[model samples]
Target: MAHDDSVLIESGLQVLKRYASRGETLSYDDLHRELGDPFKGADVAVQVGKLCDDITVQHSKATGLNLMISVLVRDSETGLPGEGFFQLAARLGRLPSTGDADAKRAFVLEQEHRVFMVFRPVKADTSGFAPNH
Candidate 1:
């Protein structure tokens, strides 16, 4: 990314954590609103989506958990992640790129719920990194 990825990842993680605690989801607009300087563009949705992916990858790498935090960030209207999430997931072999809407929606919910379950209060790691149970 042209911007500071670490900063965006940090901010995006904070926001995703808050939403996960509430068992809720947020849109890219909601995420970008709290993130630091926005990327130079007419719309920052693409930027926020990339940040979400980065957060998921970084946190998973750090925690050794396969759950994705990006699932918590979605479109407010459709209540699902943007195409970028599915595209990345497909590239990662998490989902089929040609999956239908229902299948995609199901995948998103499954991941989102998994994210919430993992982030819930637990007696695991307290290293202030990834949440654990």
Candidate 2:
């Protein structure tokens, strides 16, 4: 049987897909506006956080203007498709750990890719690194 989509999955992916299509980032408030009727309940913020947790979306810091959402593709070498929203951490130079269940999953996936790269042997070029004599 086909499983029902999680509430977060449906609404979150909808929001993300819209932004992804636009190819532009949006702040949280603007995102709420775009969401229209779906943005409701006291749990909205919590839901957004969850969305970030799931790696389906991301949230930014309170910029006094608008909280931005990250739709940037992670490193291509990582072999991950371009998706997932994550707020960037200023210090770490990457998305700050959400420290939630979702964050853990993202972390694990990242590490897994790292390990994969480490094990994969580099392809040799016919021309040596030093150059031909």
User: Judged by TM-score, which candidate is best?
Assistant: 1
lDDT of 2: 0.42
**Per-residue CA lDDT of candidate 1, range 51-113, in tens?**
888888778788888777899887988888998889878877788787599999889888988
Candidate 2, position 74, lDDT = 31
Which segments of model 1 are wrong by more than 4 Å? Answer: 1-4, 122-133
Model 1: lDDT equals: 0.80
lDDT of 2 by residue, 1-133 (tens): 0113355445654565455545434444454455563547886644444444343322222222122233322323433322233333323345564646566446545543443343345667867577659
Model 1 clashing residue pairs (backbone)? none
